[model samples]
Target: MSFADHTIRVRVPGTSANCGPGFDAIGLACTVYNDLELTLKKEAGVKITISGEGAANIPCDGRNIVWRSVQYLLRKAGLLDQYPGAVIHMENNVPLSRGLGSSATAIVAGLKAANVLIGNRFNRRELLQFATDIEGHPDNVAPAIFGGFTVSTVTRGDVECFSFLPKFRMKLIVAVPDFPLSTRKARAVLPAQVPMADAVNNISRASMLVAALCKGNEKFLRNVFDDALHQPYRAKLIPGMYDVFAAARKAGALGANLSGAGPCLIAYALERRHCEEAVGEAMKAAFRQHDVEAKILIMDLDTRGAHIVK
Candidate 1:
């Protein structure tokens, strides 16, 4: 029953939660990913090797999020003593603490890879619940598990998610600012209660957003990516946030908003129109206007959420 001979590799997408109006409810899985390779060791120490984004700051010991997640799952299955150590390798393309769900990516990758190593005793839904429990929300983890665009809600302690992949092609233009805004700090600025009007606005727009994305209705999408819930409060954390959104829209983007919490902004554009570059540059230049240097990444929706590569 030893898993020392099994090497599991899993790829998890970087997720953008909130999706403008659907605060804490909707998420989109992008093409950018973090890949994890996990090999159980018969010995008793955890070892991690990381490359790409956040490698310099990421921990390589038991403190590492990837290793912690693996340990969590293994402990749940009562296999921690039998497989007390692992060699974990992570190649991360997702930025850290920049609203790109980097932690969710790590957690999903670890859980998925660990499950594969243990004979996949956990199903995707079970994995989603485990990830949600660890993440404190299902927005990012749902899409990381199910892929595509996900609308999730937690009821009584269970996670229910509906995932959709639109037939039409769309490009995602993300402008990553130079600074990082932690989710805790971003959320701290929010008011405990919002005006009923703002709440109604978010409800309407979030519903419209889900419907439009599900139907691939481009006309409806143009106005639905606006938020009245978290974005306005979180905007102060990211300089020129609204200006970046305006620049993207003025450059023929359908819409744009904060990717998850703050700092990184994502814009949507039709693939057929070839306006992605213009939108990306517009967002980047807007950040430059505020003396913030930003990097732009052009990506598409990831349909396959997290999967074993080997």
Candidate 2:
């Protein structure tokens, strides 16, 4: 088929990073996504079009994450000169800097689109590594690449990923406030040094959480989501953080924590009905208590990773 006859579209899942004590090592892909359409043109230049959230703020030129990802893959495969220029149209649904992995989704979508446009030259692992390099971390990129709930660790300059299909039915309730907190700013609030006791505490909790997930033991998870490394320090940045967690627990959620950075809290529930009601009530009470408008969503785990639609 001619390049003009093929249209590549990729949908990438948004991720919630640092689940409880996993801290930069675990992530789950949610139902939210960003869609990208790539059409090869007979012309000689690259063109980019964007719509939806962050359209006006995101870069539209070669500096865009999507553009950079595509360019990186094409160059790595040594087909940069042979491939025809293309037009990339992005439809973004995930909000930026709200603790959602919106940037990672855009990068993964672009890489998937480029790979399809070039006839699947790179495997999923290779594509993930490339995207992770661009993202500077693998928590979000791992789940966005492998889908479902993923436990990842970066060791010796490489990312190790393990995927788990949740045995128990679980729903994620996310509450995003109107105010945005940049991930960089949130990181700044964290302390550089931590006590040994705190370190051991998080290690045990992280291990327990992972074991509970593997065994599908909800009881073990009831108190296993505690974190001593990041959440305690970052909680200062989010107003009424304790109240949000308290509200979620009171509403029958298993556990709740700051989604990725701050301002967006995520709660885990076993039943859809309970989750829905809990999310609604938690959002209302959280907003009332914190004096900030918030939006709440009930999202499921995304099983399929980034892929081309056509």
| Winning model by lDDT | 1
- Please report how far candidate 2 places residue 165 from its true position, in Å: 1.2
Candidate lDDT scores, in order, read 0.92, 0.83
- N/CA/C clash count, model 1: 0
Model 2: what TM-score?
Answer: 0.94
Residue range with the least summed lDDT across 10 consecutive positions in model 2: 271-280
Which tens-of-lDDT digit does each residue in 1-310 have in candidate 1? 6788578889999999998999999999999999999998778998789999999999898789888889889988899888889999999999999999999999999999999999999999999999998889999999999999999999998999999998689999999999988888988999999999999999999999888777888899888888888988887788899999999999999999899886899999999999999999999999999999999999999999999785
Local lDDT at 66 for model 1: 86
| Clashing pairs for predicted structure model 2, backbone only | none
- Residues 45-144, candidate 2: write the lDDT tens digits: 7789999888888988768888778778878877666564778899988888899898889888878888888788898878778887889888898888
Candidate 1 weakest ten by summed lDDT: 1-10
TM-score quality measure for candidate 1: 0.98
Shift in Å, residue 53, candidate 2: 1.7
Model 1 / residue 266 / CA error / Å: 0.4
The list of candidate 2 runs beyond 4 A from truth reads 1-5, 41-44
